[model samples]
Target chain A: MKNNQGMSIIVKTVTRVSVWLMVLYAWYIILHGHLTPGGGFGGGVIFAIAMLNVLLAYGSEFTEKWLKIRLLHDIEAASILLFLIVGILGISVLGGFLTNFILKGKLYELISAGTIPIFNILIGIKVAMSLFLAVLILAKTNIENGGEV
Target chain B: MMPTEIWLIFIISICIVGSIVALELKDILSSIIAVGVVGLGIAVSFLILQAPDLAVVQFVFEIFAVIILVRAFLKKDYHKEEPSTINKVLVGVTLITLGAIFYLSLSVFKLLPPFGQPLFETAQYYVQNGATDTGAANLVSAIILDYRAYDTLGEVTVLFAAILGTLTILRIKKSKNSQEVTNEK
Candidate 1:
């Protein structure tokens, strides 16, 4: 069975709205992570689920085209690499690894911390992309393995 | 009488019951649905504990596990009755032991006890200084990637191992493919 089918117009609309809302909420959580409870991992996964919803509603091909697997792969790799580089640079410049305040800015602004926001975005992208890959692999396996899924 | 506490209790009860249903359900599909309920419960519990980072990880892994399990179970036969008595007994004993442990732990350990002061104090110290020092508002993020960077790296590696193992085992190999065809005798 297709992931998205036999849905009333209302259900489809609700799903679409919720998916976007989740994406927005994920960002909210990540941006306010320092001041609030949620952080990079939390927000990242929520965003990933939101993406998954889109894939389920449309199709894998459309979702992949929208996200572009190549771009997703690059984002996934870049994010992990960025995380590591930030730590290494921190150790070199501030005598500790992953130190964000080495070149601190205003606390509340977008670019306040030298690397917190950057790390947040990187973590978010890495998590979402890896999860997307996992879902893709699972779907492909289900089809290739010849199951009712 | 606080509203949040009431809501929390209800959520916990739902989780416990949902897990029981997952363990007991005869239909595998329903069992999977119950597992999703259990995951939702854990995520809510994480939110209440002020660990949104953990909650997201829980949610993502929960969905991944359930989907994989469902897919794998789809091609397999489950019409035969399972020897469920042993499973039930094991689950019962485990739950009782956990409950006992939780009761004893919470009753004996005070949150702000002298011995616990240092632990919490350090956490607070990080919460305060972490933002300025790490320039990250999320103190948990600072603690995870800055204070415990090595640990986080180790965890990521562990996750990678688990995914690798799953993919390797689930893949249909040539030898197994031939055996499935000829071994029906």
Candidate 2:
């Protein structure tokens, strides 16, 4: 029972606790993007970093066994498709591509900003999955090569 | 409170010093850490300049950059090989060219508008009516996600292409590895 796939227990425990918090913070950034400094790209990068932290702590082998890379690829593709669809839908509704079609509620509210939040969420997902997939592949390749270039 | 110019100058000097240290350091790891420090200085300067969004992105990006660099370094030797002898003539020529370029660019720099003042009216419009039009309190977000969404779409497409390229390259490597294994068997 080598069980040496990841780091020491202390690091694993800390990562397990912090990973969820990071995800929550990422969601906050994405959801409140219109009202905050960070928007889709920033939130998405934060989410990707959270996933990367998990991979680093758990090792690629354990992570791949648990997390399906195929599913991530599908989600990434779907998010991009949805983003494009949203843009096209604005053309049909408002005669402008990527227009703010939704009803913009009062300012400073959570649900205001008419399609901006939607875009934020979609972009966040796309970015997170894209980055995670890239890093996952890199980690897998490195492992296969036995840490050689 | 001290003027923003003083704060900017101080932070920029720190960044310059840190970069010089990073370049001069013998240990690769220490150099990487020095670069990280310079990035932190830049993030701080961004914050001082009232660009919290850029500061946040820079901060997180710096973390990722340092992590990736350190991880890659771990896979190989940490110590540098021998330092190559510098060519004094080449250095002199490079310095002279750089100075000439700087001298030529001074006129262009003078022609540029002063800081916090833009020659374009579009910026003024965005700053004034961004929140009212987009219903987003953060003007930066409003501009990015609402006003110039097409630009953001283009950026997302670029990210998608980069990821697609990475996966394709890695997948080809995997297939080659499998083929080699099968041939050996």
Interface RMSD of each: 5.1, 3.2
lDDT, candidate 1, residue A142?
Answer: 38
TM-score of each: 0.70, 0.89
Q: Model 2: how far is B109 from its true place, Å?
A: 2.8
Model 2 / residue B121 / CA error / Å: 2.6
At residue A95, give the lDDT of candidate 1: 76
Which residue runs of candidate 2 sit more than 4 Å off their true CA positions? A1-4, A143-149, B79-82, B175-185
The lowest-lDDT stretch of 10 consecutive residues in candidate 2 chain B is: B72-81
Residues A1-149 of candidate 1 have per-residue lDDT tens digits of 34424245675577778987888998897776655566677677778778777766665656677778788767776777777887788778877776654566766665566666666676676766676677655654533333221
lDDT of 2 at A36: 80
Candidate 2 overall lDDT versus native:
0.85
Error of 2 at A114 (Å): 1.1
Q: Which pairs in model 1 have colliding backbones?
A: A34-B137, A34-B138, A101-B134
